[model samples]
Target: MNTLSYGLLSLLSFAPLSGYDLTQKIKPLWQAGHSQIYPLLASMEQQGYISYKLIEQTDKPDKKEYTITEAGLAQLRQWVEMPAEHPVLRDELHFKLYSLWLSEPQKAKELLYQRMEFCQSELDRYNEMLGGNETLREERGESHEPKATTFGRYMLIRKRIMDMESSLQFCKYALEELEI
Candidate 1:
């Protein structure tokens, strides 16, 4: 199985989710779509790594919610214990930034502005998600340390928030250097 296959299993270990749900949840962490996810789900099911239950819906087509099996859990545990490969970032913005010296000052300023906007939007989305998590915890009278089931998600969102904030600051500094 590929890395995405393992990613799907990791998500299922958190909770049973439909293919659509999995796609949305994995978007921030992995670049995957329904086109890729459905086939992998099918293959994992055949390999006895996962199983699904048909979920009936009143207004929409039925869906299959997938869950990880014991075998998948074992595989996921082993994978986690193994050293991970270095992360790969495929952002087009990086290429643009690398060649930024070739651009006019105004053009470079525009690039930084665009990146700032993108970072702000992502930061806002992550902040909203974090707010929702906090609200849910308060409603349940839970502690700051999230339950095991949600600990990974909580920490991941916080990390993304910090990343976006740092990006925005970088953009600001770049703009200042350009005297924008």
Candidate 2:
């Protein structure tokens, strides 16, 4: 299965989610759209990895809420045990920074400022997610001790929060460099 396929499965493992929900939830980690996701979901369903129930909404169109099958969970677990591929770096800001010498000082400063704002926005989002997780845990009467269901999410969000903070610091440093 492709990475996106596995990503869908991973999300389903947490809880059943509609196609729209899946598309929204996966955005922070993977770039996928309904065009790519629906087909994969269909293929996985055919392969007996996932199943969906169609729910009729009074206000909106009917939607399929997907859940991972046992086969899917087993595959997900196996995939987890396997070594992960190296992450691909595709940030356009890196290219902009590489060519910054050719750009105007004000333009460079604007780019860094935009990046700083983006980093702060992402930091706030991740912090909110972490808070939501904490609330969910407390509501369930679960202790802070790492549990199978949430440990990965908790750690991943924490790491992303750290990354965003570091990125903001780097932006500030670059802005200072541009000033000098």
For each candidate in turn, the TM-score is: 0.88, 0.92
Off by over 4 Å in 2: 136-146
**lDDT of residue 54 for candidate 2:** 94
Q: Candidate 1 vs. truth: CA RMSD? A: 2.5
Tell me the alpha-carbon RMSD of every candidate: 2.5, 2.0
Candidate 1 overall lDDT versus native: 0.88
lDDT of 1 at 65: 91
Best by TM-score: 2
Across 84-140, the per-residue lDDT of candidate 2 in tens digits comes to: 999999999999999999999999999998989999999998888777666555643
lDDT for residue 97 in candidate 1, whole number 0-100: 84
- Model 2 scores worst on lDDT over the 10 consecutive residues at 135-144
